[model samples]
Target: MCTFHGQPCTYLRGPLPRKRRKATDPPEYRSQPNGSGSGSVPGMTHLNLNYPHGLNMTIPLDHHDEVEYPSPELLEALSPSLAGSENLGPAHRQPSLLDGTLGLHLKTHSEYVGLTNYREPCLLDLHPPEDPHTRSVRRLDDFTIFMIHRDRETTSETQRIADLDAIEKVVHPLGASLVNLYFRIVHPSFPILHKKVFLEKYARSYHEFSPPLLAAVYLLALDWSIFDRTLSTSSWQPDQSRLEALALRTMNDDMKRPKISTLQAGLLIQQRAKNNTWTFTSQLIALSHGLGLHVDCSDWAIPEWEKGLRRRLAWALFMQDKWGALVHGKPCLIRPDEDWDVRPCRIEDFPENAADEEHDPEGSAEVVIGRELFLRHIELSLILSDVLRTFYTAKATRRNGTLEQIGTIGVAELAKPIVLMLRDWYAALPEALQLQGTRMKKLSANGSLHLSYTAIDLALHRALLRNVSAVAPPELRHAIRMGARTRLVSAMTIISNLQPEHTQSFWGFMASAQLASIGTFAGLLWATSDDDLEATFYCERVEEYLWSLRVRSQAVPFARDALRMLEAEVGGLGPVRASNLPMEMMRI
Candidate 1:
């Protein structure tokens, strides 16, 4: 059978033809939330403006062909809280500590771009099924043409490759150690690059790897250099700015002939907020579609290893899409009812069945829970993903403006499923993934995962508060209030537990500072929203987190800037300035 990406071409009933719309046909226009190509922020114009690549955004399949996930009932029955609040360590019992709060100065906005306005969306690049035009013949670009031959690159691509020759010197004597650091620390959380193939390829020659991928590896590793004994003591300190600039340039070049490596570089570099923007993320999602990573490949004619890799990368992209949309306050690119088709990741999909472990050459420490963190993080993303569709969507929020209009039982009923999902996620955590009394660790392998859970939980509880008050049903309001306090406490506990390992891990560059700021806000809101001694209790934890933020200020970018904003907002939050909270949330 004739196929594309090993699936039958459903429209190939006859030879290809080109036909235009007749005047009497139905209008084929619809609103594309955030997936359109345009310039609001990053340099999105030059990337996807005219790229003509086909994407199988939707498939007609039998009812039984759909994927499945655990039900809320099953999730709620999974396990109790791994770190039960009442039993939390001395931090919970001791008198509140107050050193003060910490702040960020990164300029993501250009003079031309406003931080609030979205680009004017025109039309979706996707082919509408009801379009009045007939399908045309397929076309290939030079990058794809050369990739099919297996032995060469296009001339322009070769020129692009030559531009990154300086990377060889950038790694110099520490290249191997940096790669090891990546596989050890960053890879476990991100896990985009496969261990065996990457190492095998590197053995052949540095050139065996794409400049973007190679450069991204060493660049991310540099963030964790202090943890590596060999490189930590060596006098060689590479210019991170030069490395960042090189990775960014090569990554943009890699996009010309978009491949798996292109997506890899994009995901890696974007881990740091300093290196990413909403525009850049949209470009990555577009490239992922161009490469056909969105479609299911379970039965494709590919190696078993490749199938697994594709699934992992697709889910990783999904996490990026959902989280990026939340953080960027942009429309979500992946619609659950539309373009998202990949199934939830399976255990077999990871490169290693047994979690990978790394013993530093110093023989100082070993960590193998990277897989646990990666898997659980995906689950957490799925948790927040539902919030995006259910309650936070523009349409959903607009509808929510009415107070429990009619048919629905209001916010409580609507929140039940998400509450159950979060419960099950926490309950199901393997022991290796659980935290105790917020114990600080030197590595904190699973720390980021739990910390992220607090961030997501805080978001949920905060949203619930708008619909709740003393007038709301007593039990319902109490539950939400108690839950919000719990999440704030959870966040405070984890924030103070911050370690170098956690800060330098995957997404460390941005997540550490951002989560800390979210926790501090949760505490402030708790302290002011209700009058009780409990406010002081929460404030003490906030102070502890602020102290941690101060200690890690140099290690984590934007830590102090985020704190300064919090202090300013707190200062201005007289009854007249409470409006600033939403702005701060959006900025964070």
Candidate 2:
């Protein structure tokens, strides 16, 4: 996909023979959503500006075959609060924390293009069916070639030998074709010695590629594999080691992006308030993952996709220094924030008179709801802080050649400072939330725990996004957006079901934060020690207590189910399975 005047587009390959199929056939396929569950609504689908005639489109069989499409009126009735939002406000004109010198001044315009925005997407001529159909035919710069063999059909051992032999036969041609494709996708800037080139050359001789190159190919394969599985509902399991290696490489790549000086990120937050596109701001909840935020809905027995979206959105808000409230008539921390040593600014504190994207005060109801959702986004940077520390430390150790033990005390030690920061923020909860007498009758009493847990989960979500985004190619940014959107939708749906009066109340925030925090701590603590027996005991007890507290247990099937899956995957004593323990200990 290419960014044209800041908008994104997927360029189709040159004109090909067109044989119209019957109307009953599925529509032509476009790109797939980067998430699962409750696929994108129709109206929101990208406008086919390039095809006035309207290109054919196809909905997945799982969703399309079984679920009826929403009627136009029904779609119109959807909560505008769910529409995507982007903070495309004008750039912050002020000096930022990271702006060390005048020369270091980063551009703050809507036109600003970061490394993430670099891609020229021209769709390839290859349109292989979801499954292996006819022989694969890929178009090279100079000629079209038929695949001698499908990579998927080969075993690892035979594939290695085949690749070695294949390199001797087609390496020179394959390398040239690859370079041509690379230039088509992105500008060519690196010297011949760049690792990317070296890796690509080595990729021809699959056995000769270094760990990083192999990891990149694995990640690309994973992305393709996941997309195929999601769209086709085919269960294709990848080697766990391959997934881990891919994740590690992606994390390292993310660190290389001119680190958005903390000051720059902060400035973007403030500037976004005044100049961002209404879509970005309104879509805050959905874009939470894109921004490396989290959502924690472990208390709820909701769809996994929804839960993950909410957690990420909450964390994104937290990262932007936009959550908190008054305690004892004094300022206090509501969501974790890095700007405040004690607490940070809340949504209510946003500059009221800042420029808005939709100048029309009387816009559609969807626009209004979108604005409201943006304002309600959870703000918790503590999650990102923890995630970064956790991922980097684990990665550093792994790079040192200790793959046998990935998560250990050394990793947990790296994570402790960030966790302590969260603890400190929780300690600053309002007097009502902390006091025994007031807690018995107020929202704080019932909701504080859940909110605390949600806060921590938001952090974890952010970390995971960071981990994935770090290694993902620029082409996969859409997937990242999908990931963030799914989480936002889930969180909003969960909150919408709550007592409307309490949805924005301190207790409400506290409840969500509490649930996320619990999940985060549970995961991290469990990640620390190698003793599966002990971890299982803790997980089971915690799960039981969380269920007992009526912490919206139905809102987060992803984390819960993943835990179960992980247990099954890991086998033996682990976070997934443990002797059913009492909820009593978890409360403490």
Candidate 3:
């Protein structure tokens, strides 16, 4: 009966014969709106003769015990297909009489596969979510495409249920692809090669989307993956040649690109300064301990030089931290308290809401504070600290009879001059910056409070070295000078941390100001050459200071390293011409 073998079919249709009419309900009879025993609506009257004819003609007087209807066993003889039709598949074959009936072939497939049987729209019910992860991924993907294809289009949230269902299925599959997309393609540089590699290798076969479409999809996926670890520095083991090449490339880039404008550079410096305060202080302490050159305030006179250097380092760190906070849009913690003594004044008394500037000219001076100063200060501190460490170590040699005894008198003598320089420097500052009253009161309580430590250190060193006159034989003066030089080199290591913005400035200071100062002191020593004086005086200073600081445990080895370096430098000095040497040196 069914010619089209595999044609579509509906499962629930049939053409079975109609049931016979009963006495009370004849086949042609109908109940009207008013149920007046007539086949008609409320306003119409019509007779039901045809319907009653079937009921009246029903001569089913087969009351012969109902013919003892077929037993259950006899009814089982019928085909099983008709009996079990309800259990058939949606498109299962129907009885011959039901052929071609509408909906008989309708099929219900598993929802696991999304397409509907008719290829028409169908409702998909998903669970309510606490967080819209699926929704975000789907939206981001579409947004990316929208942004790329129609740059001017607005990202509205209006969407269809089918799109929502599709989003849930795609999120997990697209995670990594999206992350790589943002880092490589959407990144500011959009390096062509990185993009190509990202598309072909990283994101290829990702959801079978077009390459351009994939790029945007990936970016959206990546946004949710950000964490703090993304910004940290991991261990980097680089090949030597590769490292060298990169360095060279960087140098080339520097040469080709115009230098950062002053304003830009200043902003950057200020930013660095704000953050560097805490970082630098913590780092310096760690580095000092690691290098075996820590200072202990209890046992020995904290050399004025060390004191000044630390102050500089601390201040620089503070300024850097302040700058960082500014860049982060945070309230500055470095600002002074608001309560200050001023003549009684009222804004209302001024004309047109403008202040009377005649009384406040000094407050209007614009000052540009930048990281350059902090960087310089840090460099100087590091340089000086290294110098002091070496000096401390050399003086601490056991043969020198406990560096404390030998260096105490000298440290004390230099303290006065160092303090004097600090006082002068403080006095030179603008009166506005100079604190008065209780602030000065606080300074007396805390000796490390001011920026005058440099002076304190210079005076301390001068006196400490002078003590050598009483402690060491006159012949040892050259050795003491050598010890001082060794420490100077160690302290200069901060130069390594100087950023490009401050590099030239630092190097210039090194070659001119710093070197000049060291040279002047070196000339005062009896050692015949730079090498001799450094080996003896500078290294010795490091030893003595370390012993006094009680960090002598580590200082001894560092002192020895400096001594060795000094020896090598002096050893390489080819024979000096007799005429070119200091004239009186030959007589010695």
Candidate 4:
């Protein structure tokens, strides 16, 4: 009974009353550790009584049967919370529970909590905040601060300080001669760079110009400079490898912040670097897109010169992508439908130098010689792009069916329109750009124009070669074989007439590879032809062409190897057919 609630209360000075036990109960429950008799109270049962150190007891009761108590040993196993918790008295001791549980609440907020939940260390701030007064006080004055800021702005500029003294020392007084050589030799095939603007910029500090462009100009000029006694007899000739490395390094550095000058530099590097043209051209395409060069700028409020530059640069990239596809056997990157509305370039786009009467607006020389070849080249490239889309693209091939379908009848059907377009393109070429006999140099732009035309024709007809043996209707097979033979003969004749010395004048890698491919194709044609007279004629002509290649440039080892292989196959003048030739010999 409770006394505070005014209920009856019973007070006991000793332990609580125990339950009464029957006679059959265990003796251990009746006897206490002090040897005194204490019976179990009602509603309680003594389950066990064991004494090892002090006292250990187990009681079973009717009311609370599920109560649990841990051993004292487990209670003492906790880690220390404070430095001297182990030495603390029982009343003062506190348990140190494991982290990330109720024990976390026991620890101080600052001790357990962190700025972030992750276990990784915090990152150090590289650009920490500074006081405005500190920043202002560090400067000497307003003029000095302005100068520092100006220098910082200039650091982002693409133009770097070129060693003009070294350049002047190398070219000496023959600077004009080198410039002339570049325009005369390299500009015709690669008209992307404007000669008039280049000279105007060059008149200023050479340090202000892009290093890669200047290096490319110097390297290309060095080739023709060999023919000039003024530069050739100089104390020092420019090192080709060094200049190339410099141009490549500068191009790579400027690639991150690409500009129109950077694109021009890349094109120049592609022309000189033989193996990296495809890779560089692909990257250049991406860079062009980043600058919005793919979009038409006619409506933009830019200078007329800038608009012309954009058009030229855009077309140049288009041509690069197209020709790169043909040369590398890769897909074209620039799609006609997706490209911008940049119009065809005009003659006025190319600035005229006061001293050059040929560039006069009223002069016929400008039409005949200046920009005519470039415009024609662009037009032909457009046609080539159409041909690639119509026949070679993956979507077109899928639409036509499998490779077998394309090889059997699809190619012949597609070749009709492309061949007609090629014919029209050739007919429209200016008479000045036509490849005339001994009157023109073999490696002139005229020669390149004709070679491009022939190459496209060959590419179109080569698809039919595989169909010649397809199990198709007799009339269809005959037509395919006849068509292939005509194109092959025409390609062979065109290649045969090319003076090997003139090929050295060409700048692009594609032309050289195409020539080798033509030679290889002719060998396959000669081997496969049923007509002995025609086969012999082609065989003799190809052999002559291969010999010319072997002597003209050591760069084309493919030609040398192909010549040997072909000579081996036809050495005995034995009867050979396409099936007898190894598959390797038939590949371009």
Report, for every candidate in turn, its global Cα lDDT versus the true structure: 0.56, 0.30, 0.27, 0.54
lDDT computed for candidate 4: 0.54
Q: TM-score each candidate.
A: 0.67, 0.25, 0.20, 0.64
**Candidate 2 per-residue C-alpha lDDT over 69-116 given as tens digits, one digit per residue, 9 for 90 to 100:** 333443335434322222111121111111111101111100111124
Please write out the lDDT profile of model 4 over residues 145-242, one tens digit for every residue.
Answer: 10001112223433355433444445555655666666655665566765544543344335535566677677677865555566767776766676
Best by TM-score: 1
Q: Between prediction 1 and prediction 2, which has the larger lDDT?
A: 1
Query: What's the ranking of the predictions by lDDT, best on top?
Result: 1, 4, 2, 3
What lDDT score is found at residue 464 in candidate 3? 49
Q: Highest lDDT among the candidates is held by which one?
A: 1
- RMSDs, each prediction? 20.2, 24.6, 35.3, 34.0
TM-score of 3: 0.20
Q: What ranking emerges by TM-score with the best candidate at the front?
A: 1, 4, 2, 3
Q: Which ten residues in a row have the lowest lDDT in candidate 2?
A: 101-110
- In model 1, the clashing pairs are 102-563, 102-564, 103-560, 103-561, 103-562, 103-563, 103-564, 104-561, 104-562
lDDT of 1 by residue, 44-133 (tens): 111122221121111111111221333334334542431243332332321110000000000000011111325211111123224222
lDDT of 3 by residue, 1-588 (tens): 232586444432222223322447532332111122221222221112222111111011111222123233433443232244332223332112112111111110001111223322111112222333211111111111000111012221232122322332343433443344333212211111112222322221232221222323332223223221231122321232332233223222222211111111121122212122444333333332221122221121222222222233233333333323322323333321231111211221111111211221211211111112233333333333333333333444334544455464444443444445444644554433322211210111011112212322342354345445345555455555445454344333322322222221111101122222222233333233335433355345433333322332142222233334333332223333334556454222
Full-model lDDT, candidate 1: 0.56
RMSD versus native structure for model 4: 34.0
